[model samples]
Target: MKTKKLNVKSRTENLSLIRDFVSSSAAEAGVTSDVIENIILAVDEACTNIIKHAYKSYPDGELIVKTKSTRNRFIISITDYGKSFEPDAIPEPDLQKYYRQKRVGGLGMYLMKTLMDDVKYVSIPGKRNEVQLSKNLKLTQQNVR
Candidate 1:
């Protein structure tokens, strides 16, 4: 499968671009509308985090979004050139505590992790950080619509 790459600056419009690409890719993969909505929401949250946290600290780097499709699956990789972040190290959001204190910052990553079936992260020594997400298409008769 060939991957689709999109390069955009850290701006609000790019978020929409990323969501559209991901959602369209999901539809092309024959995923149902519900699954497609999940994909869009997950991708949107990831992109928003990059804009707000990743590139927000540094105003010079561009965000990269790569979308790939297989016969029965779809993958989207978001790469940013800002400071390195360890997604694995982020502690799961304490829902109980947040429900009481109303904290922020970790919920976006939590939502992304929950919505996607597979999420992987790789940070090079001095290069950009990459987050790879994979989605498997369900083949039930009800899901084909």
Candidate 2:
């Protein structure tokens, strides 16, 4: 297993950097391009939510991202010191209603859930919040050849 970590301020501008890190890490792990894109999107959404909700009042708050990979799986853990949140508490959006009402928000968590193989959230009150997103690399690797 290989592990890498990145720490950045909770600012939107740093999303690109995070995306690039995920892309490179995924590619190096022999993940397919399609899966790589999914991982990137999921991580992006998770970070965006942290910046927008958890650290809403603290732009300078720290956001720590840790990535670990094995032969069959790739996992990313994002940690923030801002307010904690319960991801499972957010009900799935009603697509029909959203389209009818032309709603723009409330899609981040949905996308994260749909794109990654597993999503887990751990919140410790006023201490820390961690969101983990994992992707299965076995199937993607099987399709490589």
State every prediction's TM-score relative to the real structure: 0.86, 0.90
- Using TM-score, give the best candidate's number: 2
TM-score of 2: 0.90
lDDT of 2: 0.89
Give the per-residue lDDT digits (tens) of candidate 1, residues 21-111: 7777667667789988888888888878777776774545688888887766778899988767778677899989888987887898898
Once fitted onto the true fold, the runs of candidate 2 whose alpha carbons sit more than 4 angstroms away are 100-102, 139-145
- Residue pairs with backbone overlap in model 2: none
Pairs that collide, model 1: none
**Residue-wise C-alpha lDDT for candidate 2, range 1-80, written one tens digit per residue:** 98889999999999999999988988877788888989999999999999999998467999999999887889999999
Task: Compute the lDDT of residue 70 as modeled in candidate 1.
Answer: 72
